[model samples]
Target: MRDILVFLIVFGSIPYILRNPVVGALMWVWISVMSPHTQGWGFATTFPFAYIIAVCTLASLVFTRQPRNLPTAAPVLALLAFTVWMNVTFPFSLYPEYAFPQYTRVMKIMLMTFVVAMVIKSKEDVRRLVWVLVISLGFYGVKGGIFTLRSGGGQRVWGPGATFIGDNNALALALIMVIPLMYYLQQTSTNKWVRRGLTASILLSALAALGSYSRGGLLAIVAMCGFMWLKSRKKLMVGSVLAAVGPALLLFMPQEWASRMDTIDNYQADASAMGRINAWYMAWNLARDRIFGGGFEIYEPATFAAYAPVPNDVHAAHSIYFQVLGEHGFGGLALYLLVGITTWRTAAWIVKNAPKAPGMQWAVEMATMMQTSLMGFAVGGSFLSLTYFDVPYYLMCALVATRVLVQANLPPPAPTMTRPG
Candidate 1:
């Protein structure tokens, strides 16, 4: 039944997507990020819904009269450059067979990201996309939060299987990133009941993150909350609340969660932590030796044996920074970092400029919260290989689109007349 419903909804939307490719892009973001099909059983679980949506979207894009244009923002340009660089290094991949599949996956994500940038034309479109994200990922946030509460944080909250966020740690980081977006919606929404419900969702999602018991997630929450407070207009009030709530939530978690987090301070004693360090070292060594890096799937035993100090201590390049470094080499890592740095700057620009346009305060809030989300990703993803995650890229797309709208709506500067120069 669940599978049938998912199938019906997805297939039902194809016509609308063909009419307006933006719908396809939004649906693409939904299926790709949330992996709703993964929630169902039977045929829907194996169905290639995303591929169908992508084809329909591209067909619509080619046929539709709608004006298509990518944003000229620095972030978008950097993303394009990074995409090209990925292709450049593909032929040089150490294990092209393993790398090809992952490379294709990343390319698809990049393509959809650009589609989002081109199609999202208005503030309403941005809001709609935000709603899609919230509803899709927030399902996990709300459900996971409840599970955490009911289990007394004794069990971990996990994402749907076979998805990027399927792991507990990945799900926790994903939730942490989404929480701020929830806050953004709550702030912009006029409905009191909706705001109230969102507040509850926020609390539950935080609990869910705790339930995951990911030390990196815990650090990310701290970093994100701090950055969020810094961005708030009422910093003192926000700071006060955070100061009060932070410890209370931590105390509520079970002893096991505490012990796991405690390992952060004594990482040398933790085997998992040590393994990650070894992987990081391997990535660095590979990048130093090879110009284009080892290409995708470079975290194999052979690569680690060649580059890792402890040849026996092989592990995935758990860090996003290292993941790019090992797979793409120094140039790829530079482009990857450039994408993030430029996105951050672009969001900051929107925050600064959005206020100049009256009634654009929502844009300000959006950019600010997006920055908070980026902060969470940057911190949490440091310990996780989510370098190719669609969520962050989509966030960048929204930010880039938001900047475009904000700039367009911004009142033209009053004409200046100079007497004598």
Candidate 2:
């Protein structure tokens, strides 16, 4: 029954996707971000919904008169450069067989990311994309919040299976990032019920993040909250809410959760933490030795034996920074960082320059929330190997799209008289 429903929904959307490529893009984002089929039993669980949708979207984009102008924004260009760099390292991959599969997955994500930038022409289109994200990811957030409440925060909160956010830690970070977007929705929503629902979703998502029992996630939430408070216009209200809710959620968790989070400070005694450090060292060493790094899946025991200070300690490069450094090298890491920094600056530029006019407020809000989400990703991703995750890339696409709209709305600067100099 579940499989049938999912199949019908995905297949039924094709007609609409063909007429409007934006629908296909949103459906693709929903499938990729939510992995709704993963929640079902039978054929739907294994179906290649994203690929089918992507092919259709591309065909529609070509057949239709939709403009395919790729934005020349710094972030967009850096992302393209990064994608090209990823492919360049393919031949040099220490484990070609393993690297090939990872390469295919990441390339698909990057492909869709560019598709988003092209299809997103107006503020409404961007809002539709955000709606898909909130509905999809927030499904887990709302469910996890209820689960945490029911379980008394004893068990961990996990995301959809067979996806980037399958683990508790990954889901935690994803939720933390989405909370700010939820707030954006709440603030902009005129309907009282919609605002209330979003308000509840925001609180529930925070609870879901707390219930994940991830030490790195804990740090991430703390860092994100601090940044959100700093960026907010109504500091007193935001601060009051944080002050009231923060301690209550922490106290709601079980002692075991506290014990695990305590290891953040005493990481020397924690085997998992020590292993991550060992992997970081291995990545740094490999990046120094290889021009293009060791390529994908280079965190194998053999590579560790050759490069790791503690060669016997075979572990994944748990940090995003180290993961890219090991898999792609220093150059790849540079490009990756460049994409993030440029995207961030683009958001900042929008917030600073976008007029306070009624029609332009959405762009400002989107840019502000984009920064908040990036804050969560930056801090949470430091200890998580999510270098190839699609959410951050989508956030970059959002910022670029918003920047384009904001630029169009801004007035031209006045001409300066050369004689004055």
Error of 2 at 225 (Å): 0.7
Q: List the residue pairs that clash in candidate 1.
A: none
Counting only residues 3 or more apart in sequence or on different chains, how many pairs clash (N, Cα, C under 3 Å) in candidate 2? 0
- Residue range 1-421, candidate 2, lDDT tens digits: 8888889999999999999899999999999999999888899998889989999999999987877788888999999999999999889999998888888889999999999888887788889888888988899999999999999998989998879999899999999889989999999989999999999998898899889888888898998889989988899999999999999988988999989988898999999999999999999999999989988888788999999999999998888999999988999999999999999999999888786433687888888887989989999999999998888888887788888888787777779868764
Q: What lDDT does the true structure give each of the candidates?
A: 0.91, 0.90
TM-score of each: 0.98, 0.97
Winning candidate number (lDDT): 1
User: What residue runs in model 2 are displaced by over 4 Å at the alpha carbon?
Assistant: 356-358, 415-421
Give the per-residue lDDT digits (tens) of candidate 1, residues 64-131.
89878888888889999999999998999999999999989999999989998888888888998898
- lDDT (Cα) of model 2: 0.90
